[model samples]
Target: MADGQWWRDAVIYQVHPRSFADSNGDGVGDLNGVRSRLPHLRDLGVDAVWLSPFYVSPQADGGYDVADYRAVDPLFGTPADAEALIADAHALGLRVLVDLVPNHSSDRHDWFRRAPAGGPGSPARDRYHFRPGRGARGELPPNDWHSLFGGPAWTRAADPDGSPGDWYLHLFAPEQPDFNWANPEVAEEFRAILRFWPVRGVDGFRVDVAHGLVKAEGLPDHGRSARLLDLTSTPFWDQDGVHEVYRDWRRLLDSYPGERIGVAEAWGRTPVRTANYVRPDELHQAFNFHHLTCSWEPAALRAVVDDSLAAMRAVGAPATWLLSNHDVVRHATRLAPGADRARAATLLMLALPGSAYLYQGEELGLPEVVDLPDASRRDPAFRRTGGRDGHRDGCRVPLPWHGDRPPYGFGPAGGPSRLPQPDDWAELSAAAQDGVPGSTLELYRAALAPRRAHPALGGGDDLVWLPGDDAVLAFERGAGDEVLRCAANAGGHPVEVEVGPAGELLLSSAPVDHDGAHVVLPPDTAIWWIPARAPRAAPASAPAPASTPMAAQTPTRSSTSALGPPPP
Candidate 1:
């Protein structure tokens, strides 16, 4: 609500450091590359850049497996380079947020090495989730809750003294053992870790797997263990006391005035459960992933949006929205008719209230790369799940930088790269789209700029779907003079409707023609209306055919809306 609260209506761009750009001819992206690209991000007009984990990591889990919470990973850049990038980003009027993986660390970390196999008397033994009689030689840990990456979550290891004695729980990978948040030492360590970046001017953290920070008291075998032998417990996630941990971090974050923000990645839980992690003293916002997982039906979209909002309001916390991320199939492929559908979805995402996160390449309307080699896979989920879907590597592919050379859109190499570069840079390069009107990139900028400019559009009341042609998804944002009506055609066919005498188009994804109370919306388009100052004359054309309701209209709203449905 305050000007200082920039994050309330901010658009966050997620960058996977290794794939963003490469400055020194190495295949992977580096700090210098990202620093060099600050102007592009600034031009794009995003409020903040949410850089994925760059802390010293083993590259297991794509940097989620932290070895040093404060140092920069060599693959990314030096600590000094990171500081410079932060300064550059700030100078460009962009806020920088780093990924914090307090949940675990690389097993190769000094602490992990001290514990080795969770052996007795190891200083790091208690740093992770360890259970008795679960060593590599002993029977596996007794739970069946599958890892997010697939397979069992338990991994056997030797003690620091080379003694064989224990097993540790890894919700995602063996390298990322679950941190024992129950331990005061661990909590303090994380607090210190958080302060490290903020001291260097990092705005905040996008906390990794926030809900999975703690586990259940007893390591009981989750009933599904027979099928998932590697897991230790089902109740291990979203356990009690997580809020206490987050509340502690919230306090730490408050030490800095303004700029500080926190968003939690709370997958696998209802918005209610997710909201619990975002209370006043907890996370500033928790991700609402319902839209990403839902089908392209109006009813489905409306229900999820309503539910997610209600959940957030009930908990007195803010919500964040996302359509695609490194872990899921690109929204383009996830929707019907692919990119066109994704464009419509993006319009809805921006029009709704809350903080929005745009994944790199999403604005380019890039489709998921279905063709990927098994050897080139980056997501362990596919490996553990027998490849039900290809690994996330396809979605995490390199971004083309206006050149049709090596490394596709990434890296400094000149020829034949890891992923073949696309033939046309014009279609995807930031430079190519910056000045082109109606380009996906431009549209994204337009979509977000309005929200940033108008507070009424970023935070508001419940989005109530106006009853009319079910083909169009329409709702009112805010109240009184600030109330803006946003309507979009979620279907492939065109929609024409009455806009009430006072309505005037504020924004639209599709072409709009209005006369008096009647408004015509082209196929797959949108129109935003503000309460008109006075009544207008009527149009000459007749309204479109009112097809019998095949289904209910969908009124999707952001989770942060003061009023809305609860997330399912």
Candidate 2:
């Protein structure tokens, strides 16, 4: 990859500010907290850090409901603290990408606040999706669109006439009113917000809800499916006009000295539709949610991998692989049947032909804290849905840096964390795994070291799948002497396979036994091999064992044995 185009194959760490670290005793994480953790990221060997929203907010949706784009929230820190964090990350040779919520803003936002006080046809109301209701007395919403959290997407607006008046559209929580992108003033305001961050030395932005910015010309009812996942023909998402908005943002980003990028957090109906967001003239990259949502079944995973690679190649953009982020359950808990499977998945993801994103505590193999108290839940979806499937707070608990108790060194001594962290996280704390051999932290560090040092490992769109059983997925990256082979066994038992000319074993997610011509791969494992020679004859299958599959066992809290012994 070119020096300036560092993001193409880079490993970007997603840091949710409120959970990463808390420098202050206020029980909240701040930018200064992030600045202090720069060395941890540098040592962990990530190329960049993608911070979730820290902009001014009412904390309605974990900072996603932005009150101001330009200012840092007091809960996070001052604008100076943000600049210092950026400078510190750069000094550690890490790029900084901040989250930008363009789809909506907090109802407390200056524009949103002023818009409600005006009449239906006022200029202030035009800045948002403000329209009169369908019924004669304006009792019903303008349309039947539903909020992503739940309930009606449109909420009644208090009018200047002191009557139940026009309803404004909010695709998410009512506190987060969607912007009227059709308004010229809205587009220009965002362009200026785009310019504001780069001036502070931020490398780029991870554009929140990028595909939901522009809606259909008419605020029509979403006739059939109101599900958020069905974005293909949706009136509110992935509209054609969204591309023009991105094209404009692209121009502003490219104007900067560095190859400043815009990564779309877009969800599309198909890989091709998702790829459209990253066309040459538009955004630089988009999160591959297809790969993230794929199951552990070999056929499903292979399909997603193949489709993702082909789709991204079609757009001349590198595929971005992410296992977990702030909104979903951590991959360690959601994807794998056990810790071993999670480790294998990580190895498989890192070896893929694209950029990779790592969630904050994922390096330490943190599992989702699924049982946070109802009172401690802060996600808007949970409250809006009356505690249904909106359990995102489980994945946003504070990180355990050190110590053996609550807060786990996340904040000041004896001070509680903003969200309840599981007591079992003591074993997964960074301090506990820092130098331990065979630990998840070590495996990640070891894996990333070579990924950065090896030319064939990073930044390439070349992958040739090797013939193997349905349970095993093997592929070679690059070609000739610069080649590296990666294989994963997503099965119930060990499988022996011929890895063309038996190269040197660089790393393995689990222990492997090689017998010159055939390599025995354990179930729920993956490996990276550096090629040493040409193709070899295939090996015969070994007899199946009578024991139960390894998937039956629940992984222990601190199970580094799942990763096997340290690399020789």
Candidate 3:
């Protein structure tokens, strides 16, 4: 193993601040709420906490539309709360990583205010993409490209209509205009921002929508409007010149001494093309959201895994995997009702040979909240749904800390609570499932704890997939002296898998059937085994002593009847 390479096999827990916990009765989660929950996270055994944007913003795009990159949003908490989180997280031996949104800022940002007027010599003026207007309507200007959240890419500025003022470009929503990376000042300006946070003790950053940084020049008009669409922004996104920008940023981050992880949110087509962002100096890893986004099917999963592996091997690039994030519906709902396949997916995720990011509530197997009142919905996607299914607010619901709270363990309790407690948390709260033998949460702990202890599982290379019944995807991971085999059942029915003589079951999501030449696995489950006399296998390790058993607990919480649907 390499020094500080632990992140290569590490599992990152992504905490969405607004829904994590609310400290005061303001009905929003804050940093202090996060600090209060540190013990729960530490006990969960994550390598690091990847916090979503907490920067100052106008709240038009959640926190993505940053107004002041350096300051914390008062809604989230003060800078001291952030410092306290870092201090507490470090004390628990967990690393901290913050989100860095370099693509764009809110239209309300100070830079936009000064630019509309002829602030000719202003440095911030050129930071945004500004071009001469092109449209029939004096108020309405520019291209036919639609936003990712569903709307025209360009909006009328506050400036006088029919003026010669230039129009700004926003790929996602009109509220969030894209930045001009072509400007050397913008690139250097962000590099300076990168250097500023490490002083506050952030270990690294999760670069949000990184490939969206640069846009094609010439300002050509897109032909049609399409929701969740990409207009190519002039063909500059994911372009060749991006590599130089990454290289420059990497060099600047290297000055921090210890390794600084840079995992890019790269959303592109082919796995091979996405791998280009993960080369040695470009970016430590480019997130692999392919499998997570696809429909649940064995063949699909197999193809994605194979393609991803081939892509990385071909480019000699490191890889990172994410099953779900704030943007989409929760995996539990995707896999089965109430996220039934969460444990099985978790097993497969960790068994893979790369870094993995686990979204909050995934361990608890929480389902996505589909019903949100129009008055409460906040996401742009939900708004455009025409009062149909709510947007990401369902997946972004507040963390369930206790069982008695509303929404089956989500926001604040009773008539009123200090934070936005869930209505009925007893069903899915960590306290409710911690010791249950068959709980999804415990199974995750059982499986993940071993990865940290076993070098073969954590640091091996050269994984070989062994054929089994169509239901099972069997594979062995080994590099040099370390070797281990993982056999998993990806079907709804049990399947028999044959390994070798005298192999022992190290961990199982269900009872293993070790009879005859083949072992049987329960429906939608998996188990790992090691050779009895392998030369390079890491020594066997046990689950932490304090971990509780499943049988002793009763369902202490109520149903989803208590709390209302998630915030809009």
Candidate 4:
């Protein structure tokens, strides 16, 4: 609503740094690689760029186990490289957001390393959750908790004298020991960590495990955890104490220049619980995972959208939408029917009111590499969960920038990507689609450029659902002269729907048959159309926005306006 609140409507691109781009022939993406690619983001028209963990880490859990929050991992680059990347991004009119891992640290971290040496009742041990075993000989784990990566959350460590001293809590891998947020020193240390990045011009943080940090008091025994979209299944997540930590971060962000913000990577028990992280006095926004988890059915999509919007609106926060990320199967494959369905979903997500997040390589229509050999797999979930949802490595495959061979220009000819690219990635390379009409890359560019500048799009809450069949979702956003119609055919076979008066066929996820009033949308296709007619007048008792003529046209569409809906 104000100049400083750019996050409310930002389109942020998530960069999995190690897989995004590689420079210096190292077969690894570094901060300088990100800097070199700033122009691509500028051209793509995203408002901001978010980097996943690149801090000093052991590559355990893919950088989530942080050893040093302030230093850059040599695998990525130096601190100077990070600053240069931030500066370059800003120069290219992009804001920079870094991932923050405050819930836990690498077991190799100095503090965690010295924890055992300090012995029981020591300040170092106090920083983390270290408890005595439950049995007489102290052989059993302290609690009934399970690690998110799979197995016992508690790992027993030897005492300074080499005896089994105490068991430490690690919600994820044993290398990632959870911090004791109950401790004042833990909060104070994070306070300084929060202050460290802004001075270097970080626009915001995408808080990792934002729903975590504060566990239920007394570390109560909880049953086996279910890995689901709802993170609050157990006492460890969505606790009331988590909000206080975010509120403190909000205050710290507000005091900083550049409108610094924090966006939660939180998955709550419900949309309402998720909204708590984005309250006016808390963080700027929380990711709405429904877009990724919701089914492709029309009713399901609309329901999740309404639920997400209502929840965020209650807190005066803008909703966030996403489809695929590094942690899940790429939507290109998950949504199936290949690129068309994925493209259709993209339009639907963009037409909705909120900030949108795009994962790296999504525009290139990359599908999940599901067949990676077992020996090449790196996701710990492979072993931890007995291969349940362990395909994260599939989505983390390095992006192919150009060229037509293996690696597809990801690195030097002899240098290989950390993860293998699919054989067909040659045509999917950005170079292959650079100027190809109807290419996924071009479609994204078309949608993003308009979504960025369209008067009624980007930031607003004025969306009205238009009547349509159960297979169709039709809605108009903005008001009066600035109105734009969006609809999706989330069904099999074609369905024709009347969308009031004639509108310009501005964009379509796929070719569709439509006139001014009626459109026949194919299964898994969507459209962004606008009516050309006299503007609605405001009530005599109220002020009205000045009517502006709608003349902007950008997306490439085959106008079947004269053909009407195809026979079905």
Cα RMSDs, all models: 7.0, 5.7, 6.2, 6.9
Q: Candidate 3 lDDT, tens digit per residue, 268-380?
A: 66787688787777777788878777655678887888888788776666556677788878887877732435566767778887778889888787777776555666786
Stretches of candidate 2 off by over 4 Å are 500-502, 534-568
Q: For all candidates, what are the clash counts?
A: 19, 0, 32, 1
Per-residue lDDT, model 1, residue 346, is 81
**Candidate 2 vs candidate 3: which has greater lDDT?**
2
Give a tens-digit lDDT track for model 4, residues 1-568. Answer: 3557687878899999999888877878888888887777776668889999999999889999999999999999899999999888877778889999999999989999999999987999999999999999899999898887888899998899999889999988899999999999989888898899999989889999898889998898887664644365587888999988988888888898768889898888788889889988999888888668888888889899899989989989998899999898999999997677898899889888889999999988899999998877888878787787566899999888888787887777768888878788899988887755567876787777656546566687657888867888888888757777788888888998665564555567876665556677888888876666625422111211112111122232222111121111
lDDT of all predictions? 0.70, 0.83, 0.69, 0.81
Q: How would you encode candidate 1's per-residue C-alpha lDDT over 319-425 as one tens digit per residue?
A: 56789998878898887574556777788877777778989888777778777767777676666777884367877877776754445547655633344444554
Residue pairs with colliding backbones in model 4 are: 502-516
Location of the lowest summed lDDT over 10 successive residues in candidate 3: 559-568
Winner by lDDT: 2
Residue 38's C-alpha lDDT in candidate 1?
Answer: 75
Weakest lDDT window of 10 consecutive positions for candidate 2 = 537-546
Error of 2 at 27 (Å): 1.2
| lDDT (C-alpha) at residue 288 in model 2 | 96
TM-score of each: 0.87, 0.93, 0.88, 0.93
